[model samples]
Target: MAEHTAARPRGRPPRADREQVVHTALRLLGEVGLDALTMRRLADALGVQAGTLYGYFPTKRALLTAMAEAMMSGCQDAGENAATPREQVLALARGLRTALLAHRDGARVYAGTHAVGPNTLGFSDTLIGALRQAGVDAAAAVQTALLIVHFTTGHVLEEQAATGADPELLTEIDDLHQAIAQGEYPQLAETHKELTGTDFTQLYERGLQLLTSDVP
Candidate 1:
């Protein structure tokens, strides 16, 4: 005389998973930015009820973390097969920037979240392993990994902010450039063209060199 409970049905599944939620959230982030990124909004975009998202993320912070992790996932390829620690780190840095620049307010979204997920942690491990292989101490390797991330994220944030500036701000910048061109500022005027130009790649490479110069 025992009561039997039926097993949970494993049908075709709910047609939603953490990956789909992250994808939809990323699309929404690119469309509406981080300020307007909400579970409700994401669910609406995915054509699912808001509560269903909670089943995957449990909280808004969780979703943001997942998004950041997903963003970093593509960067793993940068360091996967690099021949040297410096190259690995450089590739990782460039890859991170590329990924961040791919979405609207991407750097802001990534910089604002702490993603300790598999993909994020994997990238960290790759960097740390490379540094360790290059003879850096364990603690310093970890710190260097963090430094690379912070530097790349900060640089991308600034780059995106500048590139996305409003016309009014841009006009102000142009006016300032003209004023500087009039030789009101000697140093800035001397390098006006270079200053006004976009050479983030060189700047980024220079920074990476500074970071990795001492490594062997």
Candidate 2:
């Protein structure tokens, strides 16, 4: 009798890799938002077993970190043609904000992840170099860069959060306006327009200016 080899199992083929997993996860993030972008969901989207993802990203946080890094790609290039250190810093800040605003919940996706990937590192190095060139000390330059990043990320988080202006948020704004009009808070009443302003673009630019004003 002829020897017979066992047939290969008929099932879903393994098709996911690190890049495809991150790419699909990011797509799912945009589609369903971060909270709903689970490993099982990603695997299902990729037509693979949930355990397959662990081979590419050991944990959810690892996957998120990779996604964050991918989102930050080419951000530092925005400062390439900047004329001054201040301009370079501002360019980088604006670039970061733009990057964070590119996807739904992008800021939340990047907020707490410690991504040491090339793109993130390049952005940090370029920002710090600009700060140092503007006469800031080594430690202070690093700290200032962190402050700028924190401010940019935090501002983008609020900006993204306010994108739809839900009913509850509108009600809260109305309540604040009424409360300020009561005269119990004189200062708030005096600056009520600024307090209730919805011009995020203006606010973001002003904030960037203030953050970089002392640079040079």
Candidate 3:
């Protein structure tokens, strides 16, 4: 009788590199938004088992940090052509906002994760350097950089939330108008048009100017 051999178990699929993983995650984030872009889903998209991803990114937070870093790549270059320190800071802030708005749920992905990667560090260093060049003290420069970043990210977060024809925002505006008409908010009645304006670009630019007006 011929000897019978047992069938061997299949091994896991080839692992994806860090770059591929991050890019794929970003694509999925755009497709399904952040909450649905789970590790299992990412693995299925990559043709690998979920456990295999842990080899490249030990935790979901690690993967998010990598994605945040990828999104921030080249943001520092925005300030390269700026002629003044204040201009450089504004350029960098604008670049960051643009980067965060590039992907769906982009601001959400970047909001809380602490990405210490080269790109993130480079962006931070460049912004702080510009602030320092503007005659800011080291401690104050770091603080100012943080304040700028916070403002940009927060604005982008609201911007993204107000996308897709934002019915909720419309309702809020309507409610504000009604309140003003009822004489409940005298100041709002006077400036309701500006308060309810949808021109986020103008709003962001104005806020940036206010923040940096004292820089020099």
Each model's backbone clash number:
0, 0, 0
RMSD of 2: 3.2
C-alpha-based local distance difference test score of model 1? 0.82
Cα RMSDs, all models: 6.8, 3.2, 2.5
Best TM-score among the predictions, by candidate number: 2
Q: What TM-score does structure 3 among the candidates reach? A: 0.89
* Candidate 2 segments exceeding 4 Å error: 1-12
**Ten residues in sequence with the least summed lDDT for candidate 3:** 164-173
TM-score of predicted model 2? 0.90
Q: Which pairs clash (backbone N, Cα, C closer than 3 Å) in model 1? A: none
Better of 2 and 3 by TM-score: 2
Tens digit of lDDT per residue, candidate 2, span 1-216? 999999988986878878888889889988989888999999999999988889888899999999999999999898999998888999999999999999888999999999999999999999999999989999999998998999999999999887743568888888889988975898898899898777998999998888777799
Better of 1 and 2 by TM-score: 2
TM-score for each model: 0.82, 0.90, 0.89
